[model samples]
Target: MQGAPGKRIAWLPTLVAKRQDTLRAGHLRFAREAPWSGVLHCFVLDCSGSMLGGQRLALAKGLLIALFDRAGASRAEAALVCFGGAGADLRFGPAVPRWWNERWLRPVGGGGGTPLASGVRQAAQVLELSARRKPAQQRWLWILTDGRSSDQPVRPRHADEVVFVDFERAAIRLGRCRTLADAWGAALFAPDELIA
Candidate 1:
């Protein structure tokens, strides 16, 4: 119906039935009934030295703002985490839909070695704490980084969902990060795809 044969199918009863059952028995109904109270999205940003080049940090900031706007429109909660130099800093909050904004996400001056392990550890801690406070809320962690760090910690055990946005170019060779992401069972995306 939408485009070509690959784009649409006239008879998809099995698939539709499966989707309906999933909606009825899974989190979909719950999410729809109480959207604002049902989910929390955490944006974990890497402010390491590598991000200083190519206006990456600026782009990240803009993306964060856009994410906040989208989350707000959907009545979801959001938080911000910046990691690099020293460690991960919980910059914004476990803030509600209305409170998230650019002011909470100021440009973090960067100039030191990347400490990805510390940042991941801190993000896991924050997520754990948030879970404790709001057990019913579904959690989503979005990690944006160049995947250049060598000292990243063991992947967090408590992440309900995790997405890694790789800022590295296609010409660059894969590093430990690909292994790390695979081990963590997180979805990996390219920065160009996400930001552009």
Candidate 2:
């Protein structure tokens, strides 16, 4: 639809969908289905000091590898944003991670503050960019954190769905992840719950 004109026309669906909008110069827009419409899984990981103390970061890394592997098999794309210390950094791509493995994530260390807001903000940027690049592709945000942060960031509006993977294992739980999930209407799961 972007390049080729007069391509395969989804007539009825297009007409029905576009009925609300006014057409220009009585010219109909032909719509063609993307040859491969895949999903993009954006992960926002917390690499804070609290996560490291309980081996939560280690477990989260393991889970990332698994999820990346799944995305590869499904022919989907993935991105990784890691937050710790004072800021958040994009560690991986918004493209298909064909070369994903433990080696790529083994060096992801944990330290400093949780910086949950920074992590979510960085991920929101990624999701917004992905939405522009692949408007038809579905986007899912996966936030893996220990709920050790005091920051409560706004949820990314571009994400079609969101998931909160809680990694809290402390004797005294904060339950911040659960609160975020409830507020955002996102699916909540513990690391163990996901594994099983």
Candidate 3:
């Protein structure tokens, strides 16, 4: 899926299809299990300008859809939050089981600046609210970003678990993400490692 830098973006339909297939299979494996009573997985995606290149946003959307399918099969609830251009928005819902889907996720065009702090803060709030409603539910926060933002949150105190998936290419240096992950005691995974 490599492309010349600065060229107009091209949509890769095949890749999207393949991603959906893989995720569907993964979800099928979990479908046999008894439904978890109370659990929510929140996927926070970075929709900043930096994600426009390398089809990062496309891949992320695919991953989110896949995750939703898998979580649903496991009988877990899910939600979505997207942040970019100085603000964060809760695009999807705190829907349980069948409520999550690709249709809920809007295609976010990349431009302006990255508001990383806004995204993180909003995600934490979502988790906090969920915890209040369903204290027994296990909450997981999965953050996908290139880690190119200049702003950062003080620290998140709400999530039961946080995982940072850095999509930045190998040539680029990961600034603040490692530190942020360390501070939050969150698991950190890179794109290369995840796809491998």
User: lDDT of all the models against the reference?
Assistant: 0.68, 0.83, 0.70
Count of clashing pairs, candidate 2: 0
- Model 2, 28-110: lDDT tens digits are 54544454666789999999898887688999999999889878876789999999999999999998989899999989998
What's model 1's lDDT at 16?
Answer: 24
TM-score of each model, in listed order: 0.76, 0.81, 0.75
**How high a TM-score does candidate 1 get?**
0.76
Alpha-carbon deviation at 127 in model 2, angstroms: 0.5
The pairs that clash in candidate 3 are none
**Candidate 2, poorest ten consecutive residues by summed lDDT:** 10-19
Estimate, for each residue in 127-189, the C-alpha lDDT of model 1 and write its tens digit: 898889887676778888777787757777666777777676536656555677778776666
Off by over 4 Å in 2: 1-35
Question: TM-score rank, highest first?
Answer: 2, 1, 3
- For model 1, give the RMSD to the true fold: 8.1
Order of the predicted models by lDDT, top scorer first:
2, 3, 1
- Cα miss at 72, model 1 (Å)? 1.6
